[model samples]
Target: MDLMARVTAVVGGVMVMLQRVGAPRTQAVGTKPVIPSARKQGIMTLKMPTAKGWASGQLPKTAPGLKVNAFASGLDHPRWIEVLPNGDVLVAEAKEQPNPPKTLMDRATQATMRRARAIGVSANRISLWRDADGDGVAERREVFLEGQNQPFGMALVNGTFYVGNTDGIVAFPYEEGETRLNGPGRKLVEFKPGGHWTRSLIVSPDQSKLYAGVGSLSNIGDQGMQAEEGRAAIWELDLASGAARIFASGLRNPVGMAWEPVTGALWTVVNERDGLGDETPPDYLTSVEEDGFYGWPYCYWGGTVDDRVAQDPQMVSRAITPDYALGGHTASLGLCWMPAGTLPGFSEGMVIGQHGSWNRSVLSGYRLIFVPFENGRPAGPPQDILWGFLSEDEKFSYGRPVGVAIGPDKASLLMADDVGNVIWRITGV
Candidate 1:
């Protein structure tokens, strides 16, 4: 057998061993140290639950006094969501376009992605769902826009609607309650794309600038720093003049971003590096600072040097610690703050949709969680609001939660589940 075949055989054996032994440790949550216990270099554990759709008359379990129901179904990989001023919900139905493998590692990565159901042709469209009668379910669904390059993040400022496509930000003229956008949008800025393709966009509080999160082209800068220009950082764009600049640097894969209502500070959820054992170097939710660096490809969790990379003592010393650690390899993607007085017991907190894990012996995430906030910071332990996406034996998943947003009534929470092709609506009883 050739090298690729031999490697595959070895990894297959390792998966069998892991399934028998179970996870090395229970997942760690919140801001805490995940002590490094390195495994053999270049040998990664693969553990992804097989995707299974919900059974008939089945629904996700929710917290007491809260109800869970499908707001819309049969979507084509709905990944992100945005609510408009006129009570309309916009869903970004997209998937990553497959890339040709150039090396053995590339092929291995693609194999893992396939098992996780993470790779597919892009839908390249956004759909609008309106609940006109104020019922929990959407009464109208229509294609709002189409023919875009893997569009993700979306925003509206004044009369212009902006979309953060994989390669750039584009804008379309829009009016309230309009279901279709016919004209092609003009590009505001271009981005270098390779590794992390999801571009998350949000407008500043003052409405003068837009912020777009562009992740790194490769994990730990394996493609060299030159290939990483204008990536792994958030870019601030001036709405009036179209000028742009880097807002923050050294974040490996920042996905979901939101502004803290009390402090007006920007916050983001970052998917950290892998292969450092199942526990070390946890993924995190942090407050982003202007001109700040959060230690990617060098150090992690503030000053804990990653010996895998060429060490830079000065840069390590300058690294800032994250505000909270979600869990290693959990792939936490969706983030949105709860509007006060929306849900009785869950008001004034942040809702996070963890898309689950693929690099460990056991699964993590795959549910929606709530973290209570006080004085503009996370205050209490994460509360499980919606769960049971994974099977009882943990070998299969009914769905994986992604983007989250407050519903039009401001009382229900909307979650985008890419795997099950369903949008879930959660409301207090």
Candidate 2:
């Protein structure tokens, strides 16, 4: 009874607080958002919308000239998507790894996550979907691989399949059209695991090395720097030698990485830390450089000292300013280079799946967006490609967008909606 009452009280309080929350700041959207003085959050803002699966005959609202349809549905928390050259789709279904609450705040946060459907036993496997015909919708679904420690990213290179398991990178022999991987995969590189667990994998354009994005173990290194060792940075693995090393540092939580075609630069969308005011430092999309620092615990937005973490003025000095702001707490987790004509009116840019915010009073990201790139840099304001995730009253979300990929068809766009358990495909109207 007590547990039920606490959950109920939290849900009820969510409705009350959301009504009084302020709107997202407009100036915080472009190449140079005014970074405001950091105001520590009191009462630790917790405002998660209740998860309500989509109703019958429902669809996400598309942009002016695009249309959206369910490429795949009835999934078990499909969080990321990848496409193979054979035109098969691999959906990485995962969620938060189990962690017992050690403090009162932890318990409260877990309860809130439950109310929001953000807490679930990770499926810990990748499922393959196929569209044998030229249709946009997938006709069959089957398990491709299983028994992983919360796998998120996947890659196929030189006839070998790689799974970015939370603890390490594993490899298995793969054929062109096999729907299932029967043999046990061998681990190539090991990670510490736990903390932020989404290990996104990408192959360098030259196809010489593999890169994986590993997030920090604590919000702001609260658990100490030792725990954060081998974390909060991107790791590069040399396939031939089976050797790995950190490629970049201080990214906080870098989820997606894509090479900007024009400049041959690696770009990523990072989820900035919370507890700061609603818009103190926005999550950003920036070109990542080798051995670069983007300021995790000690600073943010290029040298803005956090003062909360142990001061590292020298490290802060090396922190490179991010290229573009994604609105504070948007939770932009997905990124893919959309070549020109992938969508109408959008040309040569990045598509981001903002999973939305749970702690913000006024929610920031519950939609899929596109930022056009010109000469390897963000050119103008962002454009919403799909929205209407939240309810009319802002009390519920029918679905939340996450990972994104160009569909097997090559011209269409695909996105994972974890809350709704669906993968949306967008194409020209």
Candidate 3:
């Protein structure tokens, strides 16, 4: 390379570094901040502005016409959330486990146990938050169910509420405003538990089948592809007959699942296998086709084979497909269809919450995005809808959005912040 060209490149790199290091905290002049790195793409992440404290943590205040309110607070380890038609909300308090001993049998085993403890949080019970008076505040907050193992996914079907536990599935009879269950919850399905325990539960659009996602125990492997333990597959259950079978396999960590309204197809937000450097396996938002293999523990993002597991002969034939793929380590979660005809421009799109990741050096996600579709298919790249949950500095995050649910009013969106233990209500301006 020429000496002058090399000198210019070095100076430009130094200038970009200095600018980012000394960037002002004030809001950027234009609509969105321009990120100098090619990795930022077009979307920008902004730090949440200061606001008056309502409860314990900071509340995100919306613009003049846009109203931001906290539905409930002071909960213990709240995670995935669901809003009922009668203005009641159901929240899964993540179940916490006791920390294991520092010294283990081997280094690999100890590392696995440590990661398991770090990711796990306290939410073994379900809590119901009800606002009887239309006051934007919840007056009644009570536990709906207890003694359940690390439950995450939840669905209400024909007056029956189903909960997805770490190792099994259970169902309870649910009334519109009832806060507690009368009898013990009945077991629906049972499965082996793994390290990554973000199981998502959903039923078919016609209410005929129950769909559940089981993430892989290990990040990536090819030795035990079809083994019963680290299966990393999506399953379908017969609601009436109590029968269950694998629907799709090779998904690393399918955390969020929702049935698309327009296509009536199951769409999942999957966190693909990590540890292959900065950008190896891209987390994907894709439809769950029958008997499909998503190439986990081997291939990812449209046959982009992993260098670690590429030599596995079994993965060579598994044809993989993804509708839309987000960048690596975004930790996509909780997807829902925007209420049709309610918001002017969101009728034809789906909203997904990208629960930011901590593994990467520079954190990404911590916002909800809209993947627009036309005639029941993806239109283009995913667009940022509600962001500003994390700052560019990456030191502090106000809230980690894990769940997205269309509100009971049909005019607003409810996001569950697991870290802050609160539910944020976002309304149109």
Top TM-score hit? 2
Model 3 misplaced regions, further than 4 Å: 1-57, 61-65, 95-121, 222-230, 310-314
- Say which prediction, candidate 1 or candidate 3, comes out ahead on TM-score: 1
Clashing pairs in 2: none
Per-residue lDDT of 345 in model 2: 80
- For TM-score, candidate 1 versus 2, the one ahead is 2
Per-residue lDDT of 1-429 in model 2, one digit per residue for the tens?
249437645764764375335534553778889866777765567777888989999999999999999999999999889899989999999888659878777777777787677876889889999999978999989999988889999999999999998899999999999999976689899998978889999998888899999999988999899999999999999888878999999999999989999999999999888877777789999999999988888899998999788898889889999999998888999999999988888888999999987657677799999999998899998999999999977788999999999998778999999999999999999
Clashes of each: 0, 0, 4
1-429: candidate 3 lDDT, tens digit per residue: 234334433543343344345333331111122212223211122112121123454566443445567787877657788777677888888843534534322222333222322244455788888878866678898888887788888888899888888887888988777888756688878877656776778878778788888888666663355444535889898998999999988788887887776777888888876454223345778888888888776666646565566456566467576777666567888788775664545646678888766434345677777777777777776766666566546544666678888777777778787656678787766
Ten residues in sequence with the least summed lDDT for candidate 1: 33-42
Model 2's TM-score against the true structure: 0.96
**lDDT (Cα, 0-100) at 269 in candidate 1:** 93
- Worst-scoring 10-residue span by lDDT in model 3: 27-36
Candidate with top lDDT is 2
lDDT scores of the candidates, listed in order: 0.85, 0.88, 0.67
Candidate 1 runs further than 4 Å off: 1-24, 37-41
